[model samples]
Target: MLSEQKCEACSIDAVALNKGERDTLLLELSDWHIIEREGIPQLEKVYKFKNYKQAWAFSNKVSELAEDEFHHPSILLEWGKVTVTWWSHSIKGLHKNDFICASSCDGFVENE
Candidate 1:
């Protein structure tokens, strides 16, 4: 499972996932969607919470996880929801690490 995997170091020259690979990995992440920003594809998901406190806490957890994995994401924390967009800036597109991190983020709210 993606959550069981660890993110590897992504260099500037690393190749992004092809369309087939991206679609396959995305199948494992039902709640996430592929979106384009500034012409770059990204994996994005909006997690809902009961309150702002819950949303904020979830965002912090994701932040800690990102730091641990050394693969960061663009996290937008708002009232009762947090939108996380993951992409390898080095490659300017989706990477395996993004799917892995997205899977981990899903785990954070499995009980919710």
Candidate 2:
């Protein structure tokens, strides 16, 4: 499964995913969107919750997921929702890791 994939270490040789590659991989994540802000690409998804505590707990779980993968995401916490965007800052674009992280976040919501 996508979430089981591990992120690779950064290297001068690492390259960002091409458009076709990104699009193809995105097929696996139906709820995610590819958004470019200020010319940088990212995979973003918003998750709704029953209440503030549920959302907060979900955010914390995602934090643990990110730490385990060593690929963090930008998390926006709200009263009943959370927005997560995953991107490889070092590459200035999306990577397979971003998609994988996004998948794990989806799993968190699923198992909640």
Best of the candidates, lDDT: 1
**Alpha carbon lDDT of each predicted model:** 0.93, 0.89
- List clashing residue pairs in candidate 1: none
Off by over 4 Å in 1: none
TM-score (all chains, Cα) for each model: 0.95, 0.94
Per-residue lDDT of model 1, residues 56-101, tens digit only: 9999999999999999999999999999999999889999999999
| TM-score attained by model 1 | 0.95
- Kindly report which residue stretches of model 2 are placed more than 4 angstroms away from their true locations once superposed: none
Task: Give all candidate RMSDs, comma-separated.
Answer: 1.1, 1.1
Candidate 2 local lDDT, 3-84, one digit each (tens): 6777777677789999999999999996899999889999999999989999999999999988987888999999999999
